[model samples]
Target: MIAYLIGNIKDKYEDFVILETNGIGYEIFIPFPFDENYIKIYIFEHIKEDCYDLYGFLTFKDKEIFKKLISINGVGPRTACQMIKTYGIDQLINYIILEDTKSLSQIIGIGPKISKRIVLELKDIFLKKYSQNIYSTYKYDAVLALMALGYSKLDSQNSVNNIFLPNDTTEDIIKKALQILAQKV
Candidate 1:
């Protein structure tokens, strides 16, 4: 299996990129856009009797998340890509942890049933395998508060995570995050 590719981006399309490595060009599907011409993409190769596809992620964590998503019975690589593209990693983790099927269903290809299944199936795995700090009630509450104040979920989660410290209350985290966000503007 091809673990990863390090090369220059020969071309880019809506959902895939052509990377040239060692004089060979490989078409790899991506979940999000890449601005950098040179990159090292962790790869996931899907092979069946007649189908072969390459899915690439910027980080190992992203590759692992993609693998986890595709492990579900009905979720395929494309659906997993769509999920990541729509919600991103942190927000998707938050949605799953909160069991918010409605938000998950808002993705283009995901419906209510699949959203519920995604939550039901991945919640425990995420709780067990991923960072326990992000699953804390205080952090979750802080992220929600930031979102309520009109911040994007990804930005809110990132800010909160960056400012969080042990023994700090949700209010403290939110206040610090707001200050950090203010400076960024």
Candidate 2:
């Protein structure tokens, strides 16, 4: 398993990115757009009988969550990518924990039955994993604060990542995030 990739992006398409490392260009499917020309990202390498694919995520947790999503009987990599792209990890976890089928069903290929299945199957796992993590709350709050300030979730996340400090309060995080977001515009 190729667990990580550190490289300069050769190209970015609608659903995938080509990262060049050591004369090799690896195409990695991504759930959201990333701006940096150079990236160091966690990777999930999926191999099947017919194809080999690599999926990248900015955070290790997101990659782990993606693996879990693909472990479900009916969910595949494409569906999992769509899920992350549509709802993001925080919102997806929130919907699952809250059993918000209506919201979950909004993703393409996810109907009421699949939504309920996802919620029922993954709620315990997500809550058990994330409930006690203080960072999760901070991430959720920062995302909401950024969204309230008119930044999309993808932009907010890119801005807020790697900026959190242990001593920083939620307000401090939001302020720092806003500053970073402003610079990108």
> Using Cα atoms with residue i matched to residue i, what is each candidate's TM-score against the true structure?
0.75, 0.72
TM-score of 2: 0.72
* Decoy 1 TM-score against native: 0.75
Against the true structure, whose lDDT is highest?
Answer: 1
Q: What is the Cα-based lDDT of residue 64 in candidate 2?
A: 88
Worst 10 residues of 1 by lDDT: 129-138
Deviating ranges (above 4 Å) for candidate 2: 132-185
Looking at candidate 1, what is the lDDT of residue 141?
94
lDDT of 1 by residue, 84-175 (tens): 98878877787887688999888777888888888899998887776454547678899999999999999999999898896778889999
lDDT by residue (tens digit), candidate 2, 51-150 = 9999999999999889888887678999999999988888777777767899988888888888888888888998788754445667768989899988
Clashing pairs in 2: none
Local error of candidate 2 at residue 125 (angstroms):
0.8
lDDT over C-alpha atoms for residue 91 of model 1 = 77
